[model samples]
Target: MRPDLELVANLIQTDARVLDLGCGDGELLHNLQQHKSVIGYGLDKDAENIGLCLAKGVNVIEQDLDEGLGNFQDDSFDMVIMTETIQSVHNPLLLLQEMLRVGRECVVTFPNFGHWRCRLHLAASGKMPVSAHLPHRWYDTPNIHLCTFNDFEALCAHLNMLILQRRVVNRHHNERSLINLAPNLFGSYGFYHLGRTT
Candidate 1:
């Protein structure tokens, strides 16, 4: 398993029902099912990913997140996870609110566009930054709403979501403690545990 996934799995509580949005290949869900004894469901727009997840004995649905999740009732799951896919979505804030609406808690992760290396690249090279965490050229990148750590936090605050935990991940997915001090500039990626305040 990837280190980032391992970190995510560790954050999840045992025996909790989980919904993983954009769950690619079902690796994390499978691991959670095996070790934590958790029930998991996945939703992704990609048919190939859904097929791969189904082959691994995971329950999956082919659905676009941008269209919204109308079928799920409020607090339908214990936790909803959206990892590395938030930046690609059309309406991130609305999606996040929906996640909160449908689950008691939500785990979200996204590439940090304001990392120091990216800033340096922009300042020195005057070109779009490319790193191990975000390795795509400007035109071909799937990310549309690239955001800094602060941006996410602000959104969370605006939506009245309470932050339970926050972590920064590097290229190898190693968690970094320095994130608490300067997440927007230093962290390459941001992981958050959130819940609705009211």
Candidate 2:
């Protein structure tokens, strides 16, 4: 399992209802079901991922995230999850709102564009950074709305979303002391657990 997914799995309670958005291959969902006894569903647009999910005997749905989550009832799930997919979405704020509407809480992860490497790359080369976490060329990148940790926090505040937990880690998905002091500069990626404010 990816380190971020492993962390997310730890956050979920046993027997909780989970809906994973952009759930590639349903790996996290499968692990949750096997270990935590959670009721999980995955939504992915990729045909290959759908086949893999079925092979694993995981409940999966074929759907595009850009279309919105109108199918699920409000507060039907204990949690919703979208990993590294926020930047690729067209309207991230709206998507977050939808996630909160359908589930009590949501877990999100994304590459932090404000890290020192990206900033230094821009300063030195005058171009977008191509680091281990963000390996794509600017033209071919799926990250259309790349943002920093601060930016995402601001967005959450704008929506009045309560941040339950936030973790910033390096490219290896390991936490470091420096990252704790200045996450915007040292953190390579960020994982957030959020819920709508009551």
The candidate scoring highest on TM-score is: 2
Query: 161 in model 1: Cα distance from truth in Å?
Result: 0.7
Q: Where does candidate 2 clash, by residue pair? A: none
**What's the residue-level lDDT of 64 in candidate 2?**
91
Which residue window of length 10 is worst by lDDT in model 1?
Answer: 171-180
* lDDT (C-alpha, whole model) for all candidates: 0.88, 0.95
- Please report the TM-score between candidate 1 and the true structure: 0.94
Best by lDDT: 2
Cα deviation of 138, candidate 2, in Å: 1.3
Candidate 1 residue runs with Cα over 4 Å from true position = 176-180
Q: What is the lDDT of residue 90 in candidate 2?
A: 91
Return the lDDT, model 1, position 4: 72
- Tens digits of per-residue lDDT, candidate 1, 1-198, equal 977777789878999999999999999998999899888888988888988998998888888989997889988899999989999999998899999999999999889999999899889999999887788999999998998988889999999999999888766666566765777887887889998787
lDDT of 1 at 18: 93
- Tens-place lDDT per residue, model 2, 44-108, is 99999999999998999999999999999999999999999999999898899999999999999
RMSD of each: 1.5, 0.7
